[model samples]
Target: MPFIKLEGGKIDKEKKERLISEFTRIASETLGIPEEAFVVLIKENEMDNWGTGGKVLSKILAERGNK
Candidate 1:
């Protein structure tokens, strides 16, 4: 069994579904694990809880006018 843990902020349902499908497919094929045996866990946090370059994601996105 394979366990995949991801910490990506604020993903929509469609993208999350696609990611799970694609990741399962590739992992199953490459690792020779059954699709049903693979586990994928995604933990989403607010942008404020994630940071880069000493700046929180929310602040960075705000400065970039993205959020």
Candidate 2:
């Protein structure tokens, strides 16, 4: 089985579905593997749990006036 893992901030269910479908479709075509043989896992983390440039992602978004 081909494993696909994605880790990031929260997203709506629809986006997750689309991501899984699209990822599997693309991978299947590129690798010549069946979609059913792929396993896709999406991990959603709180923005505060993510960090970049020595700053929490949540704080960075807040500073930029973003949600």
Candidate 3:
């Protein structure tokens, strides 16, 4: 089985479903693997727990006036 792992900030259930379906569809077409043979894993983290450029994600988003 093929595994797809996505790590990012939290998202709504609808978005997660979309991500899984889209990923499965595209990967299945490209790799010639059945969608049922693939696994999609979404790992969500709190904004304060992840960071870039040494700054917490929550702070970065705050700076950008996004949440």
Candidate 4:
């Protein structure tokens, strides 16, 4: 069995469904493994809970003027 973990900001239901489908397809094709044999875990975090280079996501986005 193979496990894939994806973690990042929250995503809408539609995007989540698409991601799952894409992941399954790629895993099955590249690894020659059945979709049922693979496990995928997605974790969503708030801006304050996620950081890069010691700066929170909100701050980063603010710096980029996307906030």
Best by lDDT: 2
Candidate 2 residue lDDT tens string, 1-67: 9999999989999999999999999999999999999999999999999899999999999999999
Lowest lDDT 10-residue stretch of candidate 2: 3-12
Model 4 stretches astray by more than 4 angstroms: none
What is the model-wide C-alpha lDDT for candidate 1? 0.91
Model 4 local distance difference test score: 0.87
Q: Relative to the unseen true structure, what is the C-alpha lDDT of residue 37 in candidate 4, on a scale of 0 to 100? A: 91
lDDT of each: 0.91, 0.98, 0.96, 0.87
Clashes of 4: 0
Better of 2 and 4 by lDDT: 2
Candidate 1 ranges beyond 4 A from true positions: none
lDDT string, candidate 4, 5-24, tens digits: 88988899899888888898
Q: Write the per-residue lDDT of candidate 3 for residues 1-67, one digit (tens) a residue.
A: 9999999988999999999999999999999999999999999989999888999999999999999
Candidate 3 worst ten-residue window by lDDT = 43-52
Which residue segments of model 3 deviate by more than 4 Å? Answer: none
The alpha-carbon lDDT assigned to residue 43 of candidate 1 equals 87
Clashing pairs in 1: none
